[model samples]
Target: MTNASLTDAQLARSIALEAGALLQAIRARGDASGKALGDIGDREANTLIVARLREARPDDFILSEEALDDQARCAASRVWIVDPLDGTREYAEGIDDWAVHIGLAIDGRPRIGSVAVPARGAVHTTDDVHLPLPAAANPPRMVVSRSRAPEIAKTVALAMGTPMIAMGSAGAKAMAVVDGRAEIYLHDGGQYEWDNCAPAAVALASGLHASRIDGSPLVYNCADPLLPDLLICRPELAETVLAAIARAR
Candidate 1:
């Protein structure tokens, strides 16, 4: 296929799907598990994603977890931020919460993105048909880390009396808000641009509110790329969620 003809969104989705499939195949072979499996998945998938994006849009810059950060990307207006394998721990342990994130940040904002949750048989993208999310729970349902639920997240949940759901991967947690399985995904411990760029793009496009926990815009393609926190929730709940987070801090 001639990728030059594809739009930015389509290219991102295609790349994400291909990378996700490759990861699935590697896992299915089962020659390795744990760190071995994760290593292969991360390496091969990053190679595939980087090569495809570079081939399709050579002028655009890329920021990937596995690849060395080309500091030059900070000067480019269009940058692709990627997490070849989010939730490596879950993936290593044979969990399905892992994902591949492909996001294009334009003018420092996530303008297009696609997240491939291969195990879930889903690829969420900015091009998706928007649907009305299920009615959010009254107190709201918050998605948190399976192992270390952030103290800030727990505090917000308690303040709002929200029900918490444990999950792996920042992309999956953010997508939970998009999928309507949960209304809020408040993260505080830490994260990078790749960790949430695609998820943020999808969430924002899906009509959910996405931003820093402090309610600032989620910028990307920075020189450092150390965006440590974010908040994604229903638009109506953004205010309430931000308020709770403020009080919690």
Candidate 2:
């Protein structure tokens, strides 16, 4: 589609879905785990997404995990930051929790985004926004990294008296909040712009609270994209989660 015909949200969703399909096809070839599989997927998906965004919105700055860092984006008002393959480890290990991320930050704020879970045949985006999520079941459920559940996340969960759900990928965990599968997704270990921009956009669109663990707004398209922490959760739980995080810190 032409640039004039597609809105930023639509472009984000389309590119993410297309790249996810490409990754799924590549993975269907056979069992190629570890670095080899991860490399192929990351390279191919990044190429597909970058080519499509460049063709569609050549004027917009683009930042991607698989691409070289370009400081020029910091000066541009609109930047598309993406993770061609979030959860590469899970993907390479033949897990279904990996995802493709496409996000557009306008004036350094996440404005539009989409997350594609190819294995699940689902794509969550800011275009078709959902109302506030219902409260999660009793005790509440917290999503955390399967391989490395950060101590801070554990501490928050304990403080809230919630149970933790092991998940793979930043996108997957964040989307879980959007899907109502979990009440909260808190990460403090570390992350970059490409890792959470799209997920944060989607979460915000879904009427959830998306911000830094300290309850600050998430800013993107920075010269240095090393965003260290994120918190996405239902509004009702935001106070408790942030409080727990603050107390733990």
The root-mean-square deviation over C-alpha atoms between each candidate and the true structure, in angstroms, is 0.8, 1.2
Return the TM-score for each candidate structure: 0.98, 0.97
Model 1 agreement with the true structure over 1-249: per-residue lDDT tens digits:
688779999999999999999999999998999899999999999999999998999999999999998898888999999999999999999999999999999999999999989999988999999988888888799999998999999899998899999999998888888998999998885699999999999998999999999999999998888999989999999998899888878
Give each model's whole-structure lDDT.
0.93, 0.91
Superposition TM-score, candidate 1 onto the true structure = 0.98
TM-score of 2: 0.97
**Each candidate's clash count:** 0, 0
Candidate 2 C-alpha lDDT tens digits along 1-249: 574479888988888888999999988897676889999999999999989898888898899999998898889999999999999999998899999999999999998999999988889999885865676877889999999999999988888789999999999999988988999999985799999999999998888999999999999988889998999998888998888899999
Superpose all Cα atoms of candidate 2 onto the true structure and report the RMSD in Å to 1 decimal.
1.2
